[model samples]
Target: MSLQIEMDDPARPDVLALLEEHLRNMHELSPPESVHALDVSRLKTPDITFWSVREGGLLLGCGALRQLSPEHGEIKSMRTPAALRRRGAGRAVLEHILVEAKRRAYTRLSLETGTPAAFDAARRLYESVGFRECGPFGDYRLDPYSVFMTLDLRPQTE
Candidate 1:
């Protein structure tokens, strides 16, 4: 499949629809108080960089990276439509975000996902990329419904 991913504006109609669906899914998987997915307005903030994955002019998936500090970033709003799952769209978007995080000199990248069975695939994706379980980061606090994961972007040393 020919996939093209680029930095995008979250306010675009297509992107807004995808993000709205993402928020709905997040709320479905976790309680409202535990749901942290950003809405269109939050995604458009200066500290957040958004990207959309497309194939042949159709949106495949989207993700965002929010800078938490000079050396740290948070993965946010990663979602591929149900019909688009298992097609590498999610991984492509994630890898693109990881590359951008490193390009921006971020030393660590973290994400918060739900602990429900509906999120098992997402957890596996993050694990496959070397993101291990971690405690809450940024302004997040401990929560039973949330699973936090992080990856260190520093070069490995022998």
Candidate 2:
């Protein structure tokens, strides 16, 4: 399938529905206090750039990058529709987010995800893309149910 990823309006009804499903799943998988997924309204902020992946008009997945600083960004709200999981839609969205982060000159990218079994695949996906486990970042604090990961975007010294 030819997947196309592009910046999307969080207010779109279909996009809102997907985000709502993501939020619902996060709440179900983690404790209320540990759930960090943003709702559609929060994702509409200027600091966040959201994207949707579509194939022939079918929404495949979505993700967002929140600028934490001039040199850093946070990955947020990554979700693939149930029917599209394991089909590379999530990976496409993630790689797209990474490209955007680099384009914005962010030196590092980080994310907070759950520690539950439901998140194993997601964690693996992040690791596959070079994201390593990290400490709480941005406004986050250490929490038992949360797993924080980060990818360094700076070029390695020779």
Candidate 3:
């Protein structure tokens, strides 16, 4: 399927619905305090750039890059519809976020995801793109239910 990824307004009805579903899923999978999924209002901040993936005008998935600093960024709200999993839509959104991070000259990209068995696929997907486990960053604190991952975007100096 031809997937198109574009910057999107998080306030739109369809986008809001998808984000709500994502938040609901996170709450179901993780403890209340451990859930860190951002709501639509937070995603509208200037620091966050949100994008949605669509095929034939149907929303397939969405993801975002939040600027942490000049050299750092955080991946947030990456979600593919349950019915559309394993169809490359999530991967496409992720790849697009990584490219956007690089274009913004971020030296590192990090993300926080659940550590439960339900998150295995997500961990594998991030690993496939070189994301490795790391300690919490940004405003995050140590939480057993959360797994932090990071990818270095800087070029090798050698």
Quick one: best lDDT, which candidate?
A: 3
Candidate 3, 85-150: lDDT as tens digits: 877988999999999999999999999999999899999999999999999999999999999999
Once fitted onto the true fold, the runs of candidate 3 whose alpha carbons sit more than 4 angstroms away are none
lDDT of each: 0.92, 0.92, 0.94
- lDDT value, residue 128 of candidate 2: 99
**TM-score for every candidate vs. truth?**
0.97, 0.97, 0.97
Cα lDDT, model 2, residue 10 = 80
Clashing pairs in 3: none
Q: Tell me how candidate 1 scores on lDDT.
A: 0.92
Measured on C-alpha atoms, candidate 3 has an lDDT of 0.94
Superposed on all Cα atoms, model 2 deviates from the true structure by an RMSD in Å of 0.9
Model 1 weakest 10-residue run by lDDT: 80-89
Q: On residues 1-158, what C-alpha lDDT tens digit does candidate 2 reach at each position?
A: 69999999987888888988888898898889888899888999999999998999888889999999999999998999886777788999999999989999999999999998989999999999999999999889999999999999998899
TM-score of candidate 2 against the unseen true structure: 0.97
Clashing pairs for model 1 are none
Sort the predicted structures by lDDT, highest score first.
3, 1, 2
Candidate 1 per-residue C-alpha lDDT over 97-121 given as tens digits, one digit per residue, 9 for 90 to 100: 9999999999999999999999999
